[model samples]
Structure formats: structure tokens, C-alpha cells
Target: MSSTQPVESEWDGAKYGREESTGVIFGMEADQVIFIAVGVVLGVLVVMINGFPWGLAAAIGLLIVFGGIGIPRIKGNSLIGWARIFFRSKSRQRSGNDQFVQKDDGVEIGFTDDGEVEIVEGPEFEIMDGSVRRGDDTPRDGKNRIRPGKPVRMSLPGEFGELLVYQLPGGGAFIYDPVLKVATMVAEVMTEKAFQLNSFEEKEDRLREWVSVQSTIARIPGVDIVQLSDQTTMISGASIRHWYEEQILKAPAVTTADGETVRQAGPDVDPFMHQSLVETIMSVENQPVHDMWMAVVLSKEKLNERIVAAGGGVAGFMETALSMMGTIENAIPTSGAYVTKWHSPHTLAARTRTAFDPDSAIQVSERGEDGVAVRQAGPMYAAPRDIKTYESDGALHRTYKIAEWPHSQARLGFLDKLVFAGDFRHTVSLYIKPRDTAKALKANERDRATWSSNDKIRDKIGKQQTARKERQIQDLVQEEDEVTAGHAPLKLICVITVTAETDRELNANCADLETRAAEANLDLRVLYGQAEEGFIAGALPFGKLEV
Candidate 1:
């Protein structure tokens, strides 16, 4: 067999668009403007009453105090704004809304460090004539009972409500909304070629294939592509034991001519040999496995159209979703490395549970079971943020967003080091939203004009333009040119979440991630107060909607 080869290709530099604030005049809010106006009016009154130069000085002092001192800038917000945010956070903490705890029995919920809940028993219900009704013999329908032949409602975290997820056959997840009929299908992407290309030709071939697929997907309206990288360390003893059991169970056996059973020659007959084999397999435990997943979210209209075309029903939903999966598989040929398959409901639940609580252990058998969907997939306990980290189901997490990308061109696989550097468990999620070509071009042109206008204004004011500002203009021009040349424009957001069992371990893993990210020419900024939202965006595959 031929050996696999490495692949390399240069990548264009990236930049983030600046967020615009609309309700501001000269970088001041309406409240600040009102305060200034009121102060100026009071100062004029003082001038009218005192009628001297002292009154004029008092008016100027009032203006300075109201506009300068009261609105002193701290970071991006004024002092008063920061105070309001601080108080709001404190209020949430005091109210215990930021923490949650649920029992396995789904009864008597309680907060970990604070908060309280009172469980009240309610009247039972009964199913009569295929309709659930109250047991009181009154003609009242049971409002909460789950009816048959309808989509099951899933209990999700607040940020992920109005969404339901089910696993497909192989190892894929289908997240959908009952009301909207929109769906996001996720499948594991085997990208070994990314790190195993032998020549520049191979790189070009791969790029061509990827771009061709992207172009096709972009043309399909109401479809969005999201790429995610989920990295986690193997659970050593459990996996080894499971593998060893499977091997012994599947060992070959033969029946003798006399109707006596005979074991296969080697390990089946030798106990010592089996033990040695088990030990050998256990040696590579705790290895890091980095998995890439590609998800496609179909808009409600597109999905409804597919369902109708397939002759609507439960079967129609299944067939339509699978047909879409087939289309994706064809669009991006897997080269026989991996087949695109949907996740079974059980597997979907396990995956979501792991997404929210990375420390949870999921057995191999759980991935193939066809049992009822796992209803309690969320974490048993969660503290959204303790200032800098979020804790959920015993794991402490610190999440970071890419504040900036490399300012210069670099190789495509530059992120390999960051993804596989440390053994600690972490997740790197990349959310890519395809933009309309015409709209994207128009936006870029607008941005270019705005930048030019701002630069000219600065020059007229005797202020010098920075090198970074000049490079930004060039970047926009290059982006516009690429889009004009048939390249699809996309909005990409990346977040990384580091998971650990303890505070110390969490900190160390975070530091390692920072160092690796720096090495990869990525600027990472900690989520800090937004750890929970960051974790969901970084660690969960369902972040397609979040992004």
C-alpha cells in the first residue's frame, strides 16, 4: 500500500468587522446628550441670575463635569453604563437565575449554592379514545400529555429552546423545530486528507473540490453550512474493557465432527494470551481524538417544500432528511474515507449530553441503540459563570473567542497545532454563514467608502492614519475582488472551550490553549462573564443557530 502524504496550502489573512452603534451622537448616548443639555440650561439660568464672569465660569465647569467626568470611558462603555451592567449581573446572581440543578428522577429541583424550588403534586391524567383527559371525569383535555403521532417536545437549555434533536442511523444529529419546521443536520467529517496531502497538486485538487461544493451549496437558497471541531481525550479504562469484551465475544468458534464445540486456535484457548492482548490494547488510552462535523441548517420553506415533494407524513420527514443527506454526500465526496449517516435518537441524546457536560461518559453501545430518545440530556447541575469560568456536571470550563486572526498569510493547516497540542479536553467550533454574493459585494463597497471617508476626515483634522487602517482597506478590496471572481463570501465565527475537572486543571489547560493559539497566530480573548454562552457556541454542535 502507498503511504499517506501531507498537504499544505497558504490561507488568506482574516479580520473582524467592527460593530456599529446607531443611537450615538459624537460617541455619546441620548442620555448623555440629555444630561448635557439640561446642565447647559441650568448654567444659563445661573448666568441670568448672577449676571457676571463667575456665572460664565460656572457654566463651563458644569459642562466639563457632566460630559467629561460623568461619562469617563472605561474600555468601550461609559462609567455609568459599566455600573448598570455590574448591578444587573449582581441582581441575576442574587435571584439565582444563573444557576440550575435537576435531579435524575425529575423531581424536587434545588440549587447548588443558592436558590430554591417547591414541587407540588398535580392530578393524574388518563388516555381515553386516543385522547388524554383529566382523571376527574370532567371533559377536559390533558394539556401537558404528549400525544402520539406528533413531534416530541424536548427540554433544552434556555438558549436552545424551540429546538428538538434526534440522532440518525450512523453518527449524525438532526436538530429541528416543531413550530418552524426548520432543521439542521449534522454529520462527522473525516478530514484526514487535510494533514495527509503529498503535493501541491493534491492541495489544489482538494481546494477545487471544496470550493466547488461550497459554490453549489451557496447557490441553494435557505441553506447554511456550519463546521465544528470537537476534541476530547479518550476514556481509558472503559474503552479498553469494552473493546476487550467485544473481541472475546466475537472470537471464532468451530463445531467438531462429533458435535463438540472447539474454540479458535489462539487467544480463545490461551487465557494468558488474552490477558496480554488486553494489556497491549490498553496502552494507547487517553489519546486525543479530534473530530470535525459539518452541519447544514435548512430554512423552513425549503424543508416544507421537500416534505411536500416527498408526499408528507412521518415517513416523508425521514425520507426528505435522508435525501438531503444524500445530496450533501454527493456534493462533497468522501473518497470512501467515511460515509455520511444520520444519528439515531439515542446517539443524539448522548452527544448533546456530552456537549453540555463534557465530563460525562457515554458507552459505545449507546451510539447504536434504537430505544426511545433520551429525554434528560441536559446537565444535572450548572453554574453558568463564576466570574471567569462556567461549571456544569462537575466539569469547569473556560471558553474563548477568536478576537483576531493572523495578519499575514499562513498555511491552511496552521490550526493543527492548536487543535492537537495538549492532551486536555477541549472543543473548537467554527460557524460559517454563507452570504449573498450581491449583498456581500454591496456591503464591502459600503465599508470601503466609509473607511475612505473616515481616513480623509482624520487627515483633514491633522491626524495620521495607522498602517492597520490601510491594511484593512486593502483586505476589503481583496475580499471584494475574490467574491467578484466566483468565490463565495462567508461570515466565519470560531470559539474554543477548554474543559477540566478542577479549577487548577482548567487554568492550566486554558493557559496551554492560549500558548498554542498564539503559536498558530490566533488572538484569543476569554469570554469572562459570558462563559455559558461561549461554552454553548464552542462545545455544542447546535451552535448553528447561536452563531
Candidate 2:
């Protein structure tokens, strides 16, 4: 062990560089094959020249050259060339440049440069660097993330390339080189449209059908009618049934000595009364028809009787009874035709004055349809003429005759008497006026003549006329019976005079009086004018004309 040989680190060039020892060839495989064939051919030539059999050696040399290189070169080139062709054909088949498809895994997709898509089994595939070209130039820089399920014409990060990596439903997409991955989302487009395709005639037919149904339902007897809309209505038959039931229930039940109670017999009943009751209850729950039944129950006479009994007659029963009576009266057709005749002094005056025409001195006529005849002064005895004047010793005297004979009595019928017998304050009025300046001056003679002529005279005359009219109106204000019973009635008449030019100031005063009377619920009437004779005539019985 101590005597072990030293190890050498450096090698001699002759031993390492020798061609036979190194087994090295300088040229390519094809060239080497050619050189070895050439060397064998030269050896064969030397062997032939040295007297060996030439034909066999040359044949052997040729066989060695062909076997060593020619067969392998042809087979290798053929396999590699076919492989390249197969790869390109596969790539083109999977290109999916212009169509869309669903993948087997239902996720991964492929797209081509021509905006086509192909859903695939695995992830998106990308072309390696410099493997695809833009026009004639191959790309050597950058990588593109591709969407397999989308169109291929979609933009990418790098220069124009054949492939792109895209995300699937569950996984992501990545580029081939650098192996970088990125996520993607599938885009969805949606659209909606609305249209009115019905014709006007179709709509009109529907409307007509609705109206026919409504009219038919409205004619159903015992049903309450209610309009819901222009084209719809609700008819309630439940109300009549309920009202019938309530009446039957309250129609005086009898109790026997044996303690058995008996109810009044109903108009009719079906075999399944319980079912009918349940059905009615269910049907009326949500329906507005129930309200009609409620009204019917409330309006029943027995229900009202019960209410009156429970709360006593004074508890709103009078008002309820009055309202019900009014409703019933209004419902009767004959009640609307009833009328009460109104009688006033004007009517009596016209009737009485008819018998005194001037044309007939002994006029005879029947008083009315009752055929009572009346004889009175005729028109000749009633017409007035101017006063005749006689002059003697520079003195003139005048004589005047009566214009017409006033009627002392007038006959009235039962209706006329009835009208005058009640509410006289509302039925009568009086108007007064002064006849002459002499009477006016006499009323105001205590004042200066000028002032009396202008204001004082008119003022005093107005006050007297108002007072006298008021007294006469008061006398008529009570009913005839009441007046006979010695009760003084209201003085309801008013009078106003304008001795001055303006009547505007009187309007407010009249309005105030009218308003006060209205607040007190009085029936006051006012009349105005300026002649004393006319006023007296108007205040008397059988005064004024009636149409």
C-alpha cells in the first residue's frame, strides 16, 4: 500500500488524439458513411490488384456502403416527414376557426383566429414560441392568454400567433412558454321584445260579451245589484235569502206546555240545510255580497223592533221611524202625485172681481164647478168717470162718483180654508203708500215747510205707513182659528220708503232684517210703494189679482 503508483492528472496528446483509439468521425453521418464506403472500395481495388477475386470483393464493398447509410437516411427522412404532416393535419382539425361546440367535460374550449369556438376536454392549448407566425414573420416575444370557448378573432397580448390559452368553467388558462395562467369569463347576451298583436274587432267582441252577462244578472229577482266597473258587476242573492231567514226566525216562536219550543215555518228549505249554511258562509266571506246581506238583516222590521225595545223608544227610534216612513212614502208611486192647493187673498180677489164687469149691470154666473149662482153689479155700474165741475160767482165746485163697489164677502173652498187656517205668518203680506201731499204734510206739519216738504213730511208719512202696514200684517199673521181664539200672531211684514233719491242705503237695511228673521226661523215678507189708496186696497180682504 505504501508503494502504490502515483496518479497522473495530465494526458499525452498522442494517446488521447489517436483516431483509432478515440473512435471519432469528422464529418456528418452521411459524409462518414460515404468516406467509409470510399475506403472499403479502395481496399477492394488493392485486394483485386494483389490477385484476390475482384468481382466478389467489389460486390461486398458496394453492399457495405448501401447498408451502412442509404437505407437509414431514406427511412429516417420518410418517418420524420410523415410525422410533420400528421401533426399539422391534427392542429388544423382542432383549429375550430368558425364554429362553436359543447365540450365533453362541459368546460374547456378552443378557438381559432377566424372567430370560431370548440369546447374541449382539457385546458386551452397554446402554440410554443416561434411556432406560429404573423403573415410571414414568426413571433419570438411575449405570450398570449386565450379563451377557448370564445371567438378566435379576440385580441391577445403578443403578436399574431396560432394559439391562445383560455379559462374553462372550473380551471384557468395559461400560455405555453413561461407557463403563466390567467382567469377568464364567458360573456352572455340577452334580448327581449314586447308586442300588441290583438285586433280592435276582437276587443269589441269581448266587451259585448261582458255587457250581455251583466244585463242578464241584473234581471235576477231578489238579488241585490252592485256595479264594480264599467264592464263588471256583482249581484248578491244572499241578501234576500238572509232577509227571508231572519224574518222566519223572528216570526213569533211558540212554546208548548210540555216545554218543547216550536219555530215558525220558513217559506222553503232544501234537504241539505247544514250544507247550504256552510256553503253560504264560505261564499260570503271574501265577497262584497256579504255587505248586501248585512244591510238586508239591518233593514228587517223585527231587527228594528228589537233595537227599539232594547234601547227604549226615545233612543233615536223616532228619527229612525221617520226616516223609514219617508223612504217608504217616497217608494210609493202615488205619493209623488199628491199635491196641496195653495190659497192667498189674490185668488179670492180675482174670483170676486169677476162678477163686477161694467158691460153687464146684472151679471149672473155660477161661482165654481159646484154650480152656486151669483148676481152682482155689471161693468157699466162699476166704471169710473171724471168729476163734473160747476162754476158760480168765480167759485168752482167738483163732484166725484164711486169707481167700483167693493165686495163685502167672498166664498172659499175647503182647501182655501185649510191654507188660511195654519201658518198664517208665511202666507200673508201687506204693502202701503201715501195718496197725497196733504196727508204727507199733515203728518209732518210741526216742522219747517221747506224741510217738511222735502224730508220731514216723507219721513213722517213713511213711519206712519210702516206702522199701519205692520199692524195690518200682524192681524193676518195668526191662523184664522187662532185669531178667533184671541191669540195675537207675529207681525211679519216690513216697509221701507226712499224720500231721498238713493235707494241703495235701504238694501243693506232690508237684507239685515231678512237675515235676522231667517236666523229666527220667521216667515217675514216685505212690500214697498208710494200710494195710500193702493196700500189700503192691497191690505183689505179680496185684494190683488190672481193668475
Candidate 3:
């Protein structure tokens, strides 16, 4: 709907950030310089030996050395790292278990390639009747089993009590606690419903304003996680038909959820009304659903430190453990055991035990059919059965990456249609991170300078002129004004998750999502082979950037 204006950032200058990094010497890590030097020497020698073959080899070596391959920078493992995997012998590399790597911050941590922090398992420990005890296989008194009641929003790894933070398996620090997520979510839904009552222009203005605010929210501190919230809506033609038939049969006596007889369609109801209602429901975009997840990542090392620091270390750590449990117990509303995907706070030793022994993965769960708050051991871990399409706990899921944003500036409420568009169940989340104001200004200035230089060059070469450069200049000036006024810029990413009963249904739903997203000024690209990680980054409120 709008023309390309280069003022808008493409990928938020991830490469440019690297260029500006003052880390190490001249924005390059020591490891990087080593790779470059080695590549240069070997490549040049090869070139001297032959000619074309050597030249091509040297070019490739330089590219890998500089990571000149593409944008967004490499996520994990530099280009040289890739070469090492193939070229170096496995025995030459040290095993992750052999030693702890000290980080720049001076914390020792064992890291997996995925970036997840390795949990240090402690000796088997337990609490019996509120008294401290040790030994893993000891019979448990059922009093402290986990219960599924009102869900609690917990700061991650901290919930495990043994850890204060979880340096996400990826690169980033996340504070898992929600300052005000629930209330904000409720308000957003309510506001959307109320928007239908507004005038067209007023609604447009409101939408644009809201979009601006989302930009701001993304810029907040430690807010880089991609958020995805999932919801299910039943709006199929069949369901609509059932409801319509029920209404027709109970016409003039239609009842509410409470069974109160409400006014119904008149006795002379038009037969075509059913067709109209069905069409409306089927055509509705967005298929609005509540209850979505926001992604959160944990600072793993901090969590471990907190756990070890509690009650003044090993001498009084037992008392500290009991005291920590009491404090957390008071915080959570549910009784029995408290379970999380990673570890259970009620069972601190769960992670410690599991770390030492992976065989004992079972935890206290909603055991038996009655579903009472029972203290019974069961497996709650949902290990996916497949990679292409993950099937866990009877649900087939897939994730879509927001590969592109609207080229044209859109109205604020442009997404309202997408919110309730198709007849499906899914989640749409925005992972927002605020960039530092100074950094934002610097990036903006650099981009503007580049554009200005290009404009000058085009003029010097007597090339055809276009307004693109001029528009960029104007935009840069406006952005500068905004930044000067203290409005920090944000780095934002969006994702969508589609759910279905089976593979076929999932594909169908994904198609529907893609179509509806286009209508809503969105461009969704299926994550394809990367469904699980994408789902975790997008669907959960954990602020984890998909590194």
C-alpha cells in the first residue's frame, strides 16, 4: 500500500552494530583476527602455487574470515567455527563436561552448543515433614506434591530456588518476572472490542497511535524476547451451523450460558439469515482468541549463584533451602508440588537429581483420573516425537516467522481484522526490545549519512533522480527530533503459531494464517524445519531472541 522509504531500518542494522562494537581491538575479537590471519596466509600461499583455483579458494577464505557472507551477523559459531567442526579431529576439542569456561563477567559455566547453561547437580536432598534430609531415593511424604491450580508467573530459574537466573540457552539475559503482563493483556483485548464503536478516522488515528506505543514497548530494558501468545477459537462452518440450528429450534426461547431465556429471532425470521451468519463467521479475519504466551529467557549463572549464596553457603545451606521453600510457598497460590518446564521450585533437588541422573525424569503430577491434588510421580516433560512437525502431548504445532513488515505505513488497528480473521486457533506475539537512545541515534545518523552519500554519487554520475533519498533525509530529521525528545527506538520482531489436531489440519491452518496475515498487512514465513525453537521463542513470554 505504501512505497519503499529507506528510512525504516531493515534488520535493525545488526551488521552495523558489529561495525560499531568497540570490543577487543578495532571491533574484532581476538579469535576473529586469528582466523583472518590464518586464512590470509594459507590462501595467499595457495594463490602463489596455482592461479584461478587458488584465487577462488582465497576469496572464500577471506569471506569466512570476515563473515562477509550476509546480514544479521552469524548467530552462534563464527564462520571459522564451522570449518573447525569439519576440519579438526573430535579428539582435539575439549569436551563440555571436562571444564567450566569462564565468561567475560568472570562466572564459570558449562555451556552446550545451544547456549543452555548446564545445571550443577547437588547431592540427593529432600525435606521430610518440613525437616531437612538427604538422599535421592528416599520415600516422599505426599504433603508437598505439585498441584495444578492458578498458574503463577515466576521469574525463571529463580523458581528452582537452587538458581537465581538462567542465562537462556541462547544469548541474552532475561528477567522472567512479569511487571504487569496480565493486566496489560486484558486491557489490550478490551480496547480492541471498544474500537468497533469508534468512527473510521478516529479508529485509524487510534490504531496508528497504538502502533507507535508498541514500538516504544519493544525498546524497554531487557525486552528482546520474541513473544507469542496462543489462543483457540471455534468458528468453523460446522460449529456455526450447530449454533444456528440450536437457535432456530429454540427460537423465541433462546437462552444464555446461564440458561436465562433471552429475546430470540422473530417468528418470521428470514431463512437466508443462516447463510448470512455463516458467511460472516467464515469470512471473519483474525479469529480473535485470548490467552497467549510471552517468551522469557533466564540468566542461568545468576540463578546458580543465588542458590549457592543462600543461607551463607554449604554450612547453613540446608536451612536456607527450607527457608526459600517457605518463602516461595507463600508466594504461589497452589498447594502440593510446583512444577515448571525446566525445574520445580517445590522440588529443588529435581534439577540437581536429574542433572546427575537423567533416568528419573518423572515428577509429581496430576496423577490418576479424578485429577485431585495428589502427590504422585508422573512424567510431565513433553518430549517431541518428530522434528519436521512436532507432536507433543497430543497436539501438533508449527511456527511462522514474521519475515516482513508492511512496506506501507499501516493504520494502528490494521491488525484488528487479523485478530479475528480466519476460523482457527493460534498465537501472535511481538518480541520487542528497546535500543539505547544513543545507539539508536548513532545508527540513524550512520544510515542517513550513507543515504546522503549515495544521493551525492548519483548526482555526480548524472543518474536518474528519485525522491527515495530525499524522503530518507526527511525521515532521519524527524527521527532525530523524536530521539532528542527522549523517545528511545525499539528493535521489534513478530511471530505466529498455528495449532491443529493433525498434520493435515495443521497445514490447512497454516495456509489460512498466511492468507489472513497478508490481508492484515503482515508477511508470515513458515519456520518449516525450525518449528520447536520458533514456537518456544514466539509462543512463550520469555524474552528470548532467536539467536
TM-score against truth, every candidate:
0.72, 0.12, 0.46
The digit string of per-residue lDDT tens for model 2 on 117-202 reads: 55545422222222312122111213321122331211111121222332222221112111111111111111111112234343
Best by lDDT: 1
TM-score winner between 1 and 3, please give it. 1
Taken over the whole model, the C-alpha lDDT of each candidate is 0.61, 0.27, 0.42
- Model 2 score (lDDT): 0.27
Deviation of model 1 at 142, angstroms: 30
Poorest lDDT segment (10 consecutive residues) of candidate 2: 289-298
Q: Candidate 1, which ten residues in sequence have the lowest lDDT sum?
A: 108-117
The CA-based lDDT of model 3 is what? 0.42
lDDT of 3 by residue, 1-547 (tens): 9997644332232110111222233234557666566666766666776678767677667666455522112433345544544343222223322111211232222223233454333212223443334222212226532111112122111112112222111111112222221111100112233566676655555645554545544443333333434344432344444455666776666567887775556233554875677777656433333433333332223234443554222212222233333333232222111212222222322222221122332221111111111011112332233433544335566777665556465544455555555566666666655577888899888766666665566678887654543544565776777779765575656667666667888888887777778887676666543444555454434444452
lDDT of 1 at 181: 53
- Which candidate has the highest TM-score of all? 1
Relative to the true structure, candidate 2 has a C-alpha RMSD (angstroms) of 64.7
